[model samples]
Target: MNSSWNPTHGWEDLVSAALVGTDRRPLPSGAATPEAELFDHAALLTVRARAGQTPREGRPLEAAPQERQPEVSRAAGDRLARILGGERPRLLTEWLQAAAARGHRLSPHLLPELLDQAARDRSIRPHLGVLAGARGRWLAGLNPAWGFLLEEVTAPGAAHETWELGTSGDRKAHLGAVRAADPARARHLLEETWEKETPQDRAAFLEILADGLSLDDEPFLENALDDRRREVRHEAADLLTRLPGSRLALRMAERAAACLHTENGELHIAPPLACDAAMERDGVRAKPPRGTGERSWWLQQIVARAPLEIWPRLFGRPPGELVRMKIPDWGREVMAGWVRATVLQGDPEWARVLFAWDPLADLLAVLPRKDREDVAAGFVRRHGLDGQLIMVLGGAAAPWGPDLALAVLEKILQVSGTQPWNLSELSRLAGERIDPALYGMAERLSPEPPIQEVAALLRFRDDMLKELQ
Candidate 1:
């Protein structure tokens, strides 16, 4: 036998013998290794080894440095809690903006939740950086989930290096930061890597340009119209259309002018015979949907892309006056295309006038919130409680002003029994959008199924809004 012994090997042998049983495999030969003595010896050895064990030491944790900025007041902290708890979450943006404006730092305990919120709602990331301050950035560095906050907090001067060296997401965020500070620099940065970027990346980066978009970007955007990717070309065209004076818009205006002309007091339209290369290069798709004819599709694109001002210029009248005029056969098509263009360009005057004529949901959503509610109220008085009007009203801001809420209430009470199907969705909308102060009026309605349901929803929303306060 070897004189030097290994404790591990000895333990292994003892364990193997114990597992096989001393009855089947006899114990090792010796007075000290007797079957009855074997267990006692093993137990002694195990106790000695265990007692001798010592844990390895690790580095000590450092205390977090104190923040120099003052913490938000308890009232403000409670408000943030309500906002993050899903009570009127849309107000979170407003709250953060206000807090940032005041230079108020969040309570350190709230940093994790705010960082988590920033991760989920990327739209709030920029605002979060200011509120979260230095400590929040430190915490973000320790966790991958909160890593996105880093880019939003990075200084503009350091952004260039990060843009060149970071991952795709980092580069995009850096681009947005640079864009806000300097639009021209943002465009140049994108141009530097334009040829190297993938088609998908190029398309995504082009969309960020819309934030600070101006006439200065028209040349680069106009050149992007010939990109190999259809999405890239479409994005470029869309941005160019927002600039009414761009050459692309001029091209579209010229095409539309040719297709539509005023003869006598009426409008005459001859849709295009073919989608020529020049038209396609200007972002008109040659292929139409399966059910639509090429000519109608071409006409819609031309009208939609051309500047809304082009119409008044061509017809020598304001949009409202021209829209009131009768076209022989294509009035609906022409008006619909113009509505789409008005929405795309976000022309509030055109949207306001068009809403008077059509009261469409898309058009209503584009108007300023107060204007939207006011317009809906006018429409409710004019048209009464119809399904279409209710749908349009749903697009306005919530907790609607007294005039609009009262109009909606009156309409609901009038049409309660007649249209149960429409009432279901309208009841839900009422609950979400009606002013909480009107809950008493809503509650007084008879406990009929639809009325009761609407009342319950309204009361619930009222309570929810109250909690936020």
Candidate 2:
């Protein structure tokens, strides 16, 4: 016996004897049976370990502030529970958005689960400010994990004290609120502390300016282009490029004008011979990616950053006519650059023309909601079922109107027999996107497994949304 062995200090010795067996390592005390003695010591150790500690007294918790907004319908809370339980979890955002829109707060029982969900998926956090209400914020203060709830609450015209003393997120939310209300004031406020801010903070604060960008911001953005950090310079140049009249845009337009021109009703090509220092300063990268040629990269950057309006003026044609014109050489490169410009400038005229030339999914963002469906349906008809067709459909606005729903459903049925495998993704998209009102029509589409799955999902969504109301 190791006379020193006791429950308080020799727990490991007791465990070692039990692990090594009675013959190899004797029990702490010679007894009737080694197993019995070992069990007795382990039991005593367990009891001592549990009873030795008392529950430490915790500070009294502050009561959660009362939430004034009415609670959502009992049915809606049950639907949220089902969503949290993994029944169509993607619809959780829709449930939260709808509940908040109707001025309803979540029931107290569901706040923890939802806060945990928002912690995982940031996209839903924006909707939580209203839906989670005052109680959620109070709950967030007690737990570090739910701190996002506190950050999301931007009191209108937040006091200057938040910017001066609050956490990083608090300062950002405060600056964003000010920016939303007055762009110039936000700019001035940021300038006051710009020199003191770290590179990362400078870059993040600069992005908030994007929400309400104007010509008034050009001087500040231009100064930022000279910032020591590469990220700061990159962000500044991007903002300037989006501002059509910025000096950087003008430089890019001039450089592009010298490279491309029209003659004999065909567009000509003249990519830059070299990427100059000025071009680099204005945000053009001199080095190309692994497979891209240097001159081709320069050409793409020049055309992309140049204002889209420049084409109509220099080419003596509207965007539609210019997009249709032949480009004998660098055809792909030129069109690709134009596509970049269309997205950055958000030129619907150019986006419409570019889509007519080539039905790109990226162009859909600039089109109106109705136009998106119309153009996407037209593309599905013209291109038929293929990878590109699926890519185009992905960009179209959801709760897809009848035209696109019918067009896609027809396409799915038309090709179901020949291409059952391809129909799965298309069918899933249809089920998820097509308006719930059209559930009956979708159910009648076909008896094929993919179509049947689509019908089932549509019906589920229909019921899901009804519960929210």
Count of clashing pairs, candidate 2? 0
Scored by TM-score, the top model is: 2
| Tens-digit per-residue lDDT, 284-337, candidate 2 | 889999999999999998899999888889989988888889999887888999
Model 2 residue pairs with clashes: none
The runs of at least 3 residues in candidate 2 whose Cα sits more than 4 Å from the true structure, single-residue gaps closed, are 1-60, 100-104, 117-120, 128-149, 153-213, 263-266, 273-277, 324-329, 440-456
- Tell me the whole-model lDDT of each prediction, alpha carbons only: 0.76, 0.82
- lDDT score for residue 59 of model 2: 61
Predicted structure 2: lDDT: 0.82
TM-score of each: 0.62, 0.75
Cα lDDT of model 1 by residue, 305-362, tens digit? 9999988878899988888887997677688789888887989899988888888988
How many clashes in each structure?
A: 0, 0
